[model samples]
Target: MEGGGGEQALSADNVRGIVLALISSGFIGGSFIIKKKGLRRAAAASGIGAGVGGHSYLLEPLWWVGMITMIVGEIANFVAYAFAPAVLVTPLGALSIIVSAVLAHFILKERLQALGVLGCVMCITGSMVIVIHAPQEQEIASVKEIWKLATQPSFLLYVALVIVMVSVLMFHFSPLWGQSNVLIYTAICSLMGSLSVMSVKALGTSLKLTFEGTNQLVYPETWFFVLVVSTCVLTQMNYLNKALDTFNTAIVSPIYYVMFTTLTILASIIMFKDWSGQSLGSITSEICGLIVVLSGTILLHVTKDYERIPQSKSIYAPLSPSLTTRLTGELLDHVEDGRASDEEKVLRRQEMF
Candidate 1:
C-alpha cells in the first residue's frame, strides 16, 4: 500500500510497526487502569490523594507493576519508530484512548459520555487527516544537518518558549493550582513531548543513517540528541503518570492526545518545515483536520452523559429538536399522511409508538 506523493509504501516494517503499536496500546491502556487503581489504594491508605499530599503510591507494588508494564509498551513504541512513519504511529495512539475508555467504564466505573466518544472520533479523524497529508521525513544528508536544524533561530526560539512555558507550569502554576487542575501536569508533559519528538527524530535519523553504513555514531551531535530525547521522555512519563493519578482516566486520554499531537506536529512543522513541500490544498486539509481535532478535545472536556434508558414508565422526554420532531409526527398524521406512502406511514407510526 503505497501512499500518494512522498509517502512510504507499506512494507514489512510498516506492518510490524502497526502490530507493535496495537500491542503497545493494549499494554499502555491496561497499565493506566491498573496504576490508577494502585494510586487509589495508596491514597486511601495514606489518607490523601496524590494531587493533594499523598505519597504512599511510591511504595505500592501494584504501581510498580503498572510502571513496568508501561515501560514494556514504551520499548515497543521505541522499536515502532524504527519501523513506521511517526505520522502513522503517533495517531494510532487513539487505540490506547479507546482501550482506556472501555477499561475505565468497567474497572473504574467511569462512564464515557456521548460527547467524549464524539470527541475521540473527531480526534482520530483529524489525526488521520494529518497523517495522510503529512510530509514525509526528509532525507538526512548527515547528523550535522540535523544539528543545524536544531540550531536554527526559529527552532531555538521555539525551544526557549517551551522552556519558559514548562517553568511557568511547574514553578508558578503547579504550586498554586496543581491539586485541582490536571492541565498543570498534562501541559508540562505535552510541552516536553514536543521537544522530545524533535530529539527522537534526530536520533532516529542518525540510527537510520548509521544502519545504512554512514556511521553517524561517531558524531557528538548524535549522542547529544540521544541524551536530550532520554531526558525529555523520562520527564514526560513522570508528569503523565502524575496526571493519570490526579484525573479521570477517560478525560486524560483525549486531552493528552489533543495536546501532545497538536504540539508535536507544531514543533515538527516549525523545526522541519514539513509543510514546505506540501501543496496549499494539502496544507489546508491538514490545518482543517487539526481544527477538527481541537473541536473534539473541547467536546471531551465538556462531556455530557449519553441518553440512558429511563427506568420508570413516565418516559421523561428530552427537549432535543429531534425528540420534538418525533413528538410532532405523532399528532401531525393528518398533515403528513397524504404526503407519505402506506409503507412510509407504517414506519412513521411504528416510530411514534
Candidate 2:
C-alpha cells in the first residue's frame, strides 16, 4: 500500500513539473518577442528625434513603456517558478527562441535557413523531453518560509550589499554595451523588470502595513531580498541576451533555459535539501534529462549557420566624373539664375568631388 502511494505521489509530481515547464516556456518566449520589438522601436525613436541638442521627450515614454512590459513579464515568470520545479521551470524558459523565431518571421521578415529551422526543432524537442521526464515528488518549501529565512539581519545585509555592488559594476562596466549591444539592451530591460517586481512587493507590504496595521514597513529584509533577486536575474539575463544576439533566438533561448533550469535544480539540492532519498530510477531520469539538454545545445551549434547577407555597397559612393559633372551643371545653372552665389557653387562643387 505504501509503495503504491509513493508511486502515485511521484506521478503527480511529474505532471506538475511538466505543466509548470510548459507555462514558463510559453510566457518567457512571448516576453522575449515583445521585448525585442519594444527595444527596436525605442531605439528608432531615440535616433530620429534626438537631434543636435540630443534631447527628446519621446525617450521617457518609450523607456517607461518598455520598463512596464518587462515588469509584467518578470512577474509572470516569478509566479510560474514559484509553483513549478526549478529545473522544469528553468529549462522551459528556453522556448523563447521558438517564440522569437516565429515573431521575427512575421514581424521582422527575417529569413530563416534550413539549418535554423532544424536547430529550432532540436531545441524544442530536447526541452520538452527534459521537462516531461523530469523526476517528480520533490518537496518545495513555502515562499513565506524562504522570505523569513532571507529576513535574518545577517543574511539580509549580505544580500543587500551584494546587489548594490553588482548594480554598481554593471553601471560602471556597462559590459553588455561594450561587448554586445543586444546584451546591454537586454540587461537594461531585465534590471527594470527586477525593480518592478521589487516595487510590487513593496506596494503589497505597504498596503498590508497601512490597512492591517502591520509593522512590515520596518523590515529591511524585504527590500534586501528584492534587490538580491533582481540583481541575480539581471546578471543571468545579460549572459542569455548575449547568447541570443549571436545565435538564432530559437536556439539560444532554449539553451539558456536549460542552463538555468539545471542551475536551479542544483541550487535546490544544495540549499533546500529537497529530493532526498529518491529512487535510482528517478535519479537516472534526472541525469538523462540533463543529457538531453546537452544534446540540444550541441545540436544548436551543429545545425546552425551564422553567415549574414553582405550589405550592398552604398549608391552614393565617392564622386565619379558623371556625378561631378551633373552636380557642377546644376550649380552653374543655379548661379546663372542668381538662385545661388559663386561661393555656394564652389562649395557645392567641392562637396561633389
Candidate 3:
C-alpha cells in the first residue's frame, strides 16, 4: 500500500511539474518581448545599445518589469526541476520559442518566414518526443549526494571543458566578431547555462529537502551550489541581453533554445545519467528527436539568410496614369522656361543642378 501510494504521489508531482513548466514558458516568452522593447527604447534615447556593451537598458523601467517577469518564471522553473527530471523540464522550454516568436511577429513587427514557422514546428515536435520518452528524475536524499555526483571525474571534466571554452570565447572571439555574429553571444550563454542548470537543480533539491525537514541548509556544499547558480545566472543574463539587442528576437530565441537545451541535456546525461536503464527503442527515439532539432535549427538559419537577400526590382513595372501625367506636366513646365535674365538663368541652373 505504501509503495502504491508513493507511485501515485510521484505521478501527481509530475503533473504539477508540467503545469509549472507551461506557466514558466508563457512568462518567459512574454518577458522577451517586453525586455526587447525596453532595449529599443534605451538605444533610441541614449544613442547606445546593449549590443555595443551599453548598460543604458539598466535605466529603463520596462526592462525592470521584464526582468521581474523572468525572475518569476525562473523561480517556477527552478521548482519544476525539483519535481521532475531535467530532460522533461528542459525540452518543454521549446514552448517558450513559440511564445517569443509569435509575440515578436505581432509586437516587434518582425516577420517569421514560412520556413521559420516550419522550423519551429519541427523543434517543438522534437522536444515533445524527447519529453515523452524522458526518464524520471533520480531520487536524491541529501545535498551531499548531489555534491558527490558533481565531484565525479566525468562531470568535473565537463565543467573544466566548459570553463576553458568560455574563457576563449569571452577573451578572444567576442571582441572581434560578437556584434556581427549571433552565435558568439548565444554560445557563451548556452555554455554557462549547462553548468548553471546543474547548480540550480542542486540548490533546488537542497531547498526542497530543507522544506521537508531534512535541513539541507547546514551543509557548506549547499551554499557552494548557491554561489554557482548565482554566478551562472548573472553571466547568462549579461550575454543574453547582448544577443537580444544585436539580433532579431525571432532568430535569437530558437537558436538559444536549441543550443541551451542541447547542452543542458548533455550535461544532465553526464551528471545524472538520466538515460540509464532506458529501453533501446526509447534511446533511439531520443537520438532521432535531436536530429530533428538540428535540422530545424539549420533550416531556420538558412531561411533567415535567404530572407536577407534583396529582391531584384523589375525594370518593366508599369507606371500609374496619374504619375505619368504628373511627370509630363513637370517636364513641360521645365521646357516652357526656355530663357531667363542672366542672373535668374544662372540661379535656375544652380537650382536644377
Candidate 4:
C-alpha cells in the first residue's frame, strides 16, 4: 500500500513539474517582448541623446517601468520554481524562443523564413521533451546545503567575472554609434534587476522601502552570488539585443533561452546538488530531453537565411525647400526677361544669391 502511495505521489509531482515548466516558459516569452517594448518606449520618451551617459534623470520613468515589468516576471518565475522542479521549469523557460519569434513577426514586422519557423518548433519540442522527462522528485536541500555547494572552489565564477570586467571595459572604450552603448545599458539594467530580486527576497513579501537595520546590508557571500548572476544575465541580455539588431527575434530569442536554460540546469545541479537521489533512467530521460531541445534549436539555425529585409519606400517624394526657392527665382527671371530694368535685374540676382 505504501509503495503504491509513493508511486502516486511521484506521478503527481511529475504532473506539477510539467505544468509549471510550461507556465514558466510562457512567462519568459512574454518577458522578452515586454522588455523590448519597454526599452523602445523608454528610448523614445528620453530621446536619443540620453544614451550618452550612464545616468539620466530623464530616463528614470522608463527604468522604473522596465524594473516593474522585470519584477513581475521574476515573481512569476519564482513561483514556477517554488512549485515545479528546477530541471523542468528551467527547460520550459526555453519556450521564450517561440514566443519571441511570433511576437517579432507580428509586432516588429520582422520576416520569419521557413528555416526560422522550423528552428522555433524544434527548440520548443526539444525543451518540452527535456522538462517532461526530467526527474520529478529530487531531494530538496536547505539554503545552508545549497550555500555549501556554491562555496566550493569554482573557476567558472572567476572566469565569468573576468569576462564581465572585460566586457565592461570594452563597452567603455567602444564608440557610441556602434550600439555598444546598448550593451553597457543592458548590463546596468541587469545589475539593477538582480539587486531588485535580492531586495525582494531579503525584505520578504511586504517589499517595504524602510531600512530598519544597517546589518541587513552585510551579507558578502549573498551579494557576491547576486553580482555574478546579475552580470551573467545582463551580458546575455545585451548580446541578445545586439543579435536582434542583426538577426530577427525569431532566430535569436530561441537560441538564447535554450542556452540559458541549459546553463541554469547545470548551475542548479552543481550549486544546489538538487539531483542527489534521482534514478539513472530519470537522468537519461532528462539528458535526452535536452538533446531534443538542442536539435530543435539547430533546425531553427538552418532555416534562417541571414537576409536583411529591404527598407520600405516613401509613398510621396519629399520636396526640398532649397530646390523650390531656386525654381521660384528661375521663374521670376523668365517673367522679367527683356522687360526689367538693369537695376531690377541686379536686385533679382542679389536676392537669388
Candidate 5:
C-alpha cells in the first residue's frame, strides 16, 4: 500500500506535466522581450508606436517569430493542463514573469532592483506552498459536466462579476483613466485572462478525453468552451500588448500576475470546488500561499518606486527679480547701515587712495 501510494504521488503524467510547464514558461518569458524588440523596430521604421493603436509590428518578421514562439509555449501549457491540475500549472507561470524580468535586465538593459530580486524569491516560496497544498483534480467524465459547472448559480455570479468589472474598465474607465492609470489596461487584460484560463481548462479536458478515444469533440459543450477560450484569449492579447507597450514590464508583469492568479484561483474554486473536500489546514495553507504571492507582486512593483517620486517644478521656473527680494533687501539694509563706516574707512583708506 505504501509503495502504491508513493507511486500515485509522483505519477509519470504529473512529472511530464511539470517539465512541459517549465519549458512553456521559459519560452513565454523570452517571447515578451522578442516581441517588444520587434515593436521598437517597427516604431523606429514608422512614426507611430504600438501602444497608441499601431499595428506595424504585424509587418515585422521579428514580431511574427515572437508570436510563433509564444504559440508554441501556449501549446505546451495547454497540454500540461491535461496531465496536471490547474493549481499545479497556473502558479508555475510565475516562472515566466521571473524569466521576463531577468531577460529585461540583460537584454533591455533594465536594472533589477534589490527588492525585485526579493520579490522573485517570495514568488518561488509561494509557489512551493501552493503546490504542496493544492487540492487534487476531480475525475471528469464529459465536457457536459464542465458546462453544468459553468452554468451553476455560484459560478454564474462569479462570471457576472467578472463581466461587470471588465465592462466598467473597458467602456467606462478606459476612456478617462486609460492613459494615466496602468491598472485600467492591466486589469482589463487580467480579467479576460481569468476567463480564458477557465475556458482553456475545459477545452483541454475535452481534447484530452478525445485523445483517449472518448471523442469529446462531438459535444456542443466542447465547442462552446473552444469559442469562449478563443474570444477571451484574443481580447486579453490585444490589451496586454497595449499595457506592455505603455508600462514597464517590471510593473505590469507583477500586477498582471497578481490579478490573473487571484481571479483564476477564485474561478477554479467556484467551478471545480477544488477546496470542497480539503481539510481546513490545506485551505489555510492555500490562502497563505496566495498572500505570499501577493507580497512578492507588491515587492516587484516597488522597483517602479523611483518613477513615482515627484519631479521638482522649480526646474522649469524661470529666474525672477523678486525671487531674491528678501535676501537682497536684507543685504541692502546691512550695507546701508555699514555705510557710516565709509567715513571712518576713508581715514584708514586715505593712505591707500
Candidate 6:
C-alpha cells in the first residue's frame, strides 16, 4: 500500500518494530543505572573516573554487564530502524527515559520529584501520539537504493553540517569546556549517534535483504556503511562514557535521548523523505507529540535532583503552614549538602588524575 496522509494501519513489520523498540528501551534504561554503580565503584577503587580520562571501569564486572545489556538493546533498535521509519522508531526512545528515571530513583538514590513523575507521564502520552500518527516506512529493494537516498544533496548538506560541528566540539570547545559542561560531551555523542543510526539502518537493511536471498555484500556501499557504523559507535561510546561518569544518570539519559532523537529524525526526513505523503494535520500532530516528549525530557532533567519533602504525620493529618515551610527548608538544605559532598569528592578525584 502507498503511504497515507492519515493514520496508517500498523503493518506486521511495524508491529514487530514497535515491540522490539519497547524491549530495547527497557534494557537500555536499566543499563544506565547499573553502569553508574559500576563507575562509582571504579572511581572509588582507582581514584579516577572516565570523566577524567580514567580506564578503571574496564576492570569492573558490573560495567561489562551494563555494556552487554546496552549492546543487546542497540541490536534490537538497529533492526527496528531497518523495518520502520525513523519517525516511528526514534520517538519511541522516550520510553527509555521513564525506565531510567524509575530505576535511578530506587537504585541510584536519585529522588524523583512529583514533576519527574509528571514528566514520565508526558513522555508516555507523547510516545502514544507519535505511534498513532507515525508515517509509513518507504520501501527500498536493495542497499544501493538506501545509498542513493543517503547521497542526495539534501542529506549530504546535513552530513557536512554535522561534521563541521563535531570537529569544532572535539578540537576546540572540548578542550576548553568539556569537563565542566555536560552539554559538551553529550552533544558530541548525540551528533555522532545520529549518523551512526542512519548507518545502522542501512547496514541492517543490507543484512536483512541478504538473509532474504539477495546478496548485498557484493556492493561496496554495504561495506562502506559498515565502516561508518563502526566508527560512529566507537565515538559515541567514548564520549557517552565520559558524560555518564561525570554527571547524574537522570540528567544524562534524557538530554541524550532528546538530542539524539531530534537529529536522527531530521536526518531521516532529509534522506528518506519519511514525511513525503503525510497529511498536514498528521505532520502537525507528530511535531506536537515530539514537543511534548521534549518538554517531558526537559522536566526530567531539571527536576532530577529534587525530592518530595516527607511529612511526619500521615492519614490527612493537619499541619501548620510554618511547619510545612520548615520541612521544605530542611529538605532543600539536605539536598544541597548531598550535592556539595558529591562535588567535593569528584574534585578530589580529578585532582588525583
Write candidate 1's Cα lDDT for 200-267 as tens digits.
76776688778888999999999998888778867776676566545544455457667777787778
**Each candidate's TM vs. the true structure?**
0.61, 0.50, 0.66, 0.49, 0.69, 0.72
> What lDDT tens digits, residue by residue, belong to model 4 across residues 1-353?
11111222335545654665455445545544454454445444445212222123235554355345434544555544534455565555446456655776687564677877876776676665555445444432333333455466652463355457545644663345334233333333233332222222223211111233323234454455445545544543444334344333334334443444454456456543546566566567677777776666556444443232111111111111100000011101112345544333322221110
**Reference-based TM-score, model 4:** 0.49
Prediction-by-prediction clash tally:
0, 4, 0, 6, 0, 0
Model 3, range 1-353, lDDT digits (tens) per residue?
Answer: 11111221235556667778778777777776777777667767777555334567789999789868766776777788887767677776556656766787798776778987997888788766765666667778999999999999999999999999999989999999998899998899889888888888888888989999999999999999888977886777678667655665446555776788778888989998877777777777777777675666555555543232122111111111101000000000111133433222221111100
Q: Estimate every model's Cα lDDT from 0 to 1.
A: 0.63, 0.41, 0.66, 0.42, 0.65, 0.70
Model number with the top TM-score: 6
Better of 2 and 6 by lDDT: 6
> What TM-score number comes out for model 5?
0.69
Worst 10 residues of 3 by lDDT: 323-332
Candidate 1: residue 344 lDDT (0-100):
30
lDDT of 1: 0.63
lDDT of 6 by residue, 218-276 (tens): 99999999899778867776776666556544555567767877888888889889888
RMSD of each: 15.9, 15.6, 16.2, 17.1, 18.7, 11.6
Which candidate would rank higher by lDDT, 3 or 5? Answer: 3
Candidate 1 wrong stretches, greater than 4 Å: 1-73, 82-88, 99-124, 241-253, 291-353
Best by lDDT: 6
What is the C-alpha lDDT profile of model 5 across 74-122, one tens digit per residue? 6787787766666667777666666767787898676789988998898
Superposed Cα RMSD, model 1:
15.9
- Give me the runs in candidate 5 sitting further than 4 Å from their true place: 1-16, 30-68, 102-111, 241-251, 301-353
